[model samples]
Target: MARAFNAKVRQREFYPGNLVLRKVLHIALDFRGKFANKYDGPFVVREVFSGEAIILSDMDGTENALPVNADALKKYYP
Candidate 1:
């Protein structure tokens, strides 16, 4: 099972200045509804930890107070 999973799993790496979108959780306080967009922000990646944690900043240069898991984000292309 581990081999099968690992075979398909590719590394997810993000660097500072990369654009990314955060996946919005349905249970989050600010979530609108099913019809709302699933992802939020073409936010900028401020820092990337060795672990799966990432720090993101808003387009206006304001950084988020907390670090988000890398799984919750995906690369954004303009």
Candidate 2:
């Protein structure tokens, strides 16, 4: 089972200064039925931890209050 799961999992890595989008949790204020975007921000990668965790900053330069798991983010082009 572990091998099967690992076979399909692609690794995600980010480096400082790269642009990325953050996953948006579907909270009450953000719920918009089925068509809402799943992620937000073209946030800048502020810091990268050892594995599967990172810190991000808004384009305007304010850091987020919490560190996010790498899986909750994806690379952003542009």
Candidate 3:
């Protein structure tokens, strides 16, 4: 029962070192606001500070530091 609860809650919490690859992510500030005009490609979780995260793009060879929340991000499991 404990394991089941943990799995359910884990789906809601976003932590550092959480690997997110090849997904359409929306980066925003303060939870709700204007989004970045461009969609970034699959990025790796480099670091998570406070409410911000440092992600590295697969292409273009650039890194972006953006503020995001767990609820504000959705993983495309397709």
lDDT of each: 0.91, 0.89, 0.46
What stretches of model 2 exceed 4 Å from their correct place?
Answer: 1-5, 29-31
lDDT of 3 by residue, 1-78 (tens): 999888777434445445444334554453444553333344445555554444443334455655444444444332
lDDT of 2 by residue, 2-55 (tens): 999999988777999999998888867645688888889999998988866798
* CA lDDT for candidate 2: 0.89
Rank by TM-score, highest first: 1, 2, 3
Global lDDT of model 3? 0.46
Q: For candidate 1, lDDT tens digit of each residue in 1-78?
A: 999999998887899999999998777655455578889999999998888899999999999989999999999999
Q: Which ten residues in a row have the lowest lDDT in candidate 3?
A: 69-78
Collision count of model 2: 0
Better model by TM-score, 2 or 3? 2
Per-candidate TM equals 0.84, 0.82, 0.34
Better of 1 and 2 by TM-score: 1
Identify the leading candidate in terms of TM-score. Answer: 1
